[model samples]
Target chain A: MASNEEILAGLAEIVNEETGLATDAVELDKSFTEDLDIDSISMMTIVVNAEEKFGVRIPDEEVKNLKTVGDAVNFISNAQA
Target chain B: MARKVVITGLGATTPIGGDVPTMWKNALKGVSGAHTLEDEWVAKYDLPVHFAARCSTPALEVLSRVEAKRMDPSTQFGVIAAREAWADSGITEIDHDRLAVAFATGIGGVWTLLDAWDTLREKGPRRVLPMTVPMLMPNGVAAAVSLDLGARAGAHTPVSACASGTEAMHLGLELIRSGKADVVVCGGAEAAIHPMPLAAFSSMQALSRRNDDPEHASRPYDRDRDGFVMGEGAGALVLEAEEHAIARGARIYAELAGTSVTADAYHITAPDPEGLGATRALKAAMFDGRIQAEDVVHVNAHATSTPVGDKPEYTALRAALGAHVDNVAVSATKSQMGHLLGASGAVEAVLTVLAVYERQAPLTINLENQDPEIPLDVVTSARKLPAGDIVALSNSFGFGGHNAVIAVRNV
Candidate 1:
């Protein structure tokens, strides 16, 4: 299983690819909708791409809980374990 | 009095050129945009017709990665052309509520739709991108343009196959005349140069099979012409009310004198051999513009180089103009740039506006032996028009027997 840092890096990469946001700016404290300014459609795209990258199933219902970068990283790390 | 609508700015990302000036210059010089298809799908599928006129410059080169990712290729072309048109119009300030967009597409987001289907089949439903519906919708281009320009008056999409683009212009004219919008961006875009469209069009015998000589494949009015060459691109025009244009000190290209659209109700794929519907559209357009047959000096014919298609357009012209048809200098532009489908009418409208404004008609290349049936004076080379109040017609006919004709008068 990957560590929390690795999951955060992978998720940030997906967000960067989808939203053209700088990977470094996608820190744990940054919110996907507020800080990153990612819309719902883009958020879905990021989630799917993140699922594929991290080899985890990010269910549609679980997407709303991934509000911040840390929330997504923790979920992905826990799911992979 | 009805408000006069004029073409204030023009833009196009065509097979021959990336912008209006370049497209216009190359058209006059008789440049052919058709070439052999380089896609692996051609060899994989072993398609019969293996050539198309793709955009000279890819849309990704101009649009940002994020922007290009969200939009399908068709919407990308439309946005590129619309941005150029908006910038060309030099209108920095306008009430967002008074601006409108009437963009069209014959086949919208084919690439996105097919890709989504492929993803669904291979990777299951979860893999399908969420933007598929928004991108695949026929009005996607119009919506994208509306969002980009903040046009709130209306974002309309008129899907009439190849006549879609010209119909957008017609709708824009009406919008301004009815005092609905002060500025209306009208255009059509098409990017269906995919393996499925190529195969489908080939099956229907609508595409030319001159694989060996792709350059001369689209020879409109030529006796040896077989069929049209498929092309992909977009064309846009910023149309504003005459008084508004003057008050803003905008450079008016020409007056959008009049427009008319009709249906044959005769055939779904084939035009009426008698050309009755097209003839009525032509005559009605002239009447709407208050233009006499003698006043019309040029025509941008909807001659897609198909054997049957070329003759019917001539029949319509002859019926509408009578003997004066012999005097009109006609240019079959598809001969050079190939057929742009829905975007054909809009691009041809831009060319027709330039023809009237510059008093010169672009050449129609590869016409070695003009078909006797189409006895209209086809402009085989750059030709000059009379230096007076002149009017020109840009004709576009689509499948489903739709005919749209627009008249542009010199300002």
Candidate 2:
């Protein structure tokens, strides 16, 4: 299973790449909607890319709960475990 | 009285050029944009036709990766052209409420629609991108441009096949006449060079089948005329009320004196042989401009190089302009640029505005044996117009029997 640190790093990279944001702006505590300006469509893109990267399928119903970067990282780490 | 409208800026990402100046220069030199399509799908699908007029610069070259991925090719072209026009206008401060957009596309986002369907059939619904619906919509370009420019007055899309672009101009003129927007960014874009549309157009016998020589395939008014060559690109113009433009000290290109749109209930795809609807449209455009036919020295004809499509436009011109049609130096720009479908009228309108401003008409290419039936004076070489107040009409007709005409005059 991917560790929390590794999952956070992967999520940061995927969010930055998908939304054209800097890695520093994609902090674990920052909300994707408020801080990163990642809209719903681009969030989906991040999920799709992250799924391919981590080999984990994040279900659609779980998407709304992953509001902050930390939430995304924890969700990915637990899903992998 | 209607408020006077003037074109303040012009932009085009066409087969001949990526910008307006380059397109105008190449058009005068009689350069052909047609070439044998080099896509692998040409061989994969084994399409009957082998040539098309692609944009001189690909959309990917002008747009960022993420931006391009989010938009369909038609919206990409529209945004590219609209941004150029807005920048060219040199208006840094804009009243968001006073701005509007009217963009036209004949077959909007055909590539995206078909590609998504292919994905659904091959990989299931989960594989399809979330942006597919917005990207494939007909009003996508209008919405994209409006959002890009922060236009709040309204965003409109007119889908009248080939006449769509000219119809957009008509809408823009009316919008201003009714005081809905002080400034309007209007034009047309198309990106339908996919294998499906190519095969479908070929099946309808609407596309020219000159596989060996791509350049000469779009020979409008030539006795050996076949059918139109499919081309993809976009053209945009920034239109402002005459007073607003003068107050801003913006450079004026030409006056959009008048515009009209009409429909022919005659047929689904073919034009009326007598050109009654087209003639009425032309006459109404001239009447709207309050200009006599003799004042109209040039015409940018919608001669798409089709066997049946070419002559009706001539008959319409003769009926609308009477003997003045003989003196008019008609230039069929599609002879070089190929038929842009929905974008053709606006592109030709830009050329017509330039012609009226510069007093020079672009040359027509590949008219080796001029069809005698079309008695109008086709400008074989670049010709100079009389240096005075002059008006030029740009004509466009579409598949649903739509006719649109706009008159531009020297300011």
Candidate 3:
């Protein structure tokens, strides 16, 4: 199982890639839409990329709760468990 | 008197180079861009032809990931080239209502359509991406370019096979002459190097099969020539009315004197053996430019290296220029760059404009033993052109009996 730090790094990379944000700017506590200014399409890309990287199937309904980097990391960690 | 149109900016992303200056430099040095394909699909499908002239720099290198993901390869190439041309023109501001786009593609978004079909077959239609329709649309490039530049006058895409690019140029000229727009950004792009097109072209005996020597496969006018090598890229130019360019103090490349588009109405695939439509197009361009054959010094012929296809262009040249065809420095640029399909005309038009502006014509490479039947003065080296006022013509013909020719004069 991947550690919380590892999941955070992966989330950071996808967020930066999909949103075109600075890598250092994407933190665990940052809100995806409010802080990163990511749109729905970008959020979709981020979810897809994270799903691929972490070997997890993120259901569409669960996407609403994963609004921040911390929320995504927690979801993936719990899903792995 | 009619308004004059001049080429103020040029851009290209081709197999020879990523940008206009580099492509032009490689062209002057007689560089060939053909290479064998390394894609696994080649072996998986056992494709007959194993080579292509891909863009020297892939579109992914220049376009942002988000932007690149949304567009098909054809649209990506068009956007890249258009951005370069727009920046090169040095135009800071213009009325959005007076700007327009005229883009072309021989076969649009082949990769996108095929990929979608493959996904549909393997994973069901539910797996297909939502962006497939816009990505695969033939007019996607023109629409994307129009949106990129905020062009409000119009956005047009002409689909005339290989002649599409030149036809776009012809349309741009007409738009300016008709006072529809002050500046028209025009060009063509093609990204059809997928397995299906390769197989189709190979089945039709239209692609070269020199698998052993890919670099020398595209030998236009050579006796040993077999067929054209498929190439992919895009070329763009900013065409502004003479008054507009002069008023802005833009650096003009060459005056787009005249352009003509005609149809053979003879065959769907093969050109008219007598070159009737081609001759008419050439003659009409000269007449439209008010330039006599004697004043024309060079021609960028659309010689695609096929045995039958190469001869008719010569016939058309002789019929159009008479004895002066002997003096015109004919250039078969496909000898080095391969056939760019619809993009060929716009690229060759850029080269012709450069030749006229720089007073140096690029050579026709790989013409080892020139065909005796077609004995026009094909440029064999970077030959110096004559000084004083001169005119040049670039000819592009395509399947479906379409013919397009543009006349460029030194400014």
Candidate 4:
């Protein structure tokens, strides 16, 4: 299972690939929509890619709860565990 | 009085060259863009035809990674060409609400659609990208261009197969004449050079099978010609009202005199054998422009190198222009650039505008023996036109019996 730090790094890479945002700027506290400026379409793309990367099932209902990068990274870490 | 429309800027990413200047230069030199296909799918599918005229420069090389990811290849070509056209016009300030786009395509986002289908079959639908719908739509190019230029007046997509591009120009002219928009970015793009289209066109005998001699495969009026070679690219023109262009001190290329569209209503895939629909379109375009046959010094023919297609176009010219057809210098540019499907008309329109502006008709290559039945004054070499005021016609006929013609005049 990926550790919390490793999950954050992997999620950052996927977000960077989809939105062209600098990986360093994708901090755990940054909001995907507000801080990162990722649109809903790109958000879905990132979620799917993140699921594949971490082998986690990120359901549609759970996507809205994971508002910030930290929420996504923790969810992915727990799902992997 | 109707507002006069003029072509203020031109852009193209074609098989022969990536920009208008390079494309025009290569066209003047009669360079053929056709070559054998290099994709692995060719051998894997055991396709009958294995050649196409791909863009000289790949889209990924020009567009940003993020931009290319969201849009389909067809939209990418349109965006590239439209951006060039917008920059070429040198318009730094314009009312966003008064600008418009009339981009067109024959086949839209084929690669994206097929890829999505494959993903659905293998990955059970969850893996399909959310962009598939937007990318696969026929109006995606128009929408993308509209967004790129902040055009709010209107965004239109005319999908008449091969005539789609010319139809877009026709629509652009009307949009300005009707006081709907001050500036309209008009053009067409096509990137259907995929395995399915190749196999489908080959099955219908619409593509040439000159795999060994791909360069000479698209000989428009050659006696031994078989069929057209597929080509992929985009062409764009910035059209503005004459008063608006003059107020901005824009460098006008030529006046977009008139345009007309018609339908064969006879056959779906084949043109009217009697060339009735095409003749009417040609005559109407001239009449709309108030031009006489004698004033028309040149023509950019829609001769796609197909055996049956070349003759009807000649018949239409004869019927429309009467005896004056004998003096008109005709250039079948598909002989050099292959068939760009929907994009053919827009690219040919750009070339026709250049011809009237420079008074030079680009050469039509690979005509060793012209078909005796349809004797035209084909430009076998780079030929000069007469000085003083002159007019040129660019004819584009598409599948589904759609016919479109545009008349351009020296300014």
Best by DockQ: 4
Q: Write the per-residue lDDT of candidate 2 for residues B179-202, one digit (tens) a residue.
A: 999899999999999999999999
DockQ scores for all the models shown?
0.86, 0.58, 0.23, 0.88
* Chain A TM per prediction: 0.94, 0.92, 0.92, 0.96
Give the TM-score between model 3's chain B and the true chain B. Answer: 0.99
Estimate, for each residue in B71-136, the C-alpha lDDT of model 1 and write its tens digit.
999999999999999999999999999999999999899999999999999999999999999999
lDDT of candidate 3 over A1-81, digit per residue (tens): 899999998888887666567888888899988988877766776787777789887887998988888898999998888
lDDT for each residue of candidate 3 in B1-411, tens digit (9 for 90 to 100): 999999998989999999999998988899889999999999999999999899999999999987898899999999999999999999999988999999999999899999999988996764566678888999999999999999988999999999999999999999999999999999999998899999999999999999999999999999999999999999999999999999989999999999999999999999999999999999999999999999899999999999889999999999999999999999999888889998999889889999999998987989999999999898988798999999999999999999999999999
Question: Any runs in candidate 4 off by more than 4 Å, and if so which?
Answer: none
Q: Which 10 successive residues of model 3 chain B have the least lDDT summed? A: B123-132
Candidate 4 lDDT by residue in tens digits, B66-165: 8899999999999999988999998889998999999999999999999999999999788999999999999999999999999999999999999999
Q: Model 4: what TM-score?
A: 0.99
Candidate 2 residue B257 C-alpha distance from true site, Å? 0.9
TM-score of predicted structure 2, chain A: 0.92
Badly placed stretches (over 4 Å) of model 1 are none
Lowest-sum lDDT 10-residue window in model 2 chain B: B123-132
DockQ of 2: 0.58
Count of residue pairs whose backbone atoms collide, per candidate: 0, 0, 0, 0
Model 3 whole-model lDDT (C-alpha atoms): 0.92
For all candidates in order, state the fraction of native interface contacts they contain.
Answer: 0.77, 0.46, 0.08, 0.77
- What stretches of model 3 exceed 4 Å from their correct place? A1-12, A23-35, A47-81
Quality class of the docking in candidate 4, CAPRI style: high
Angstrom error at residue B134, model 2: 1.3
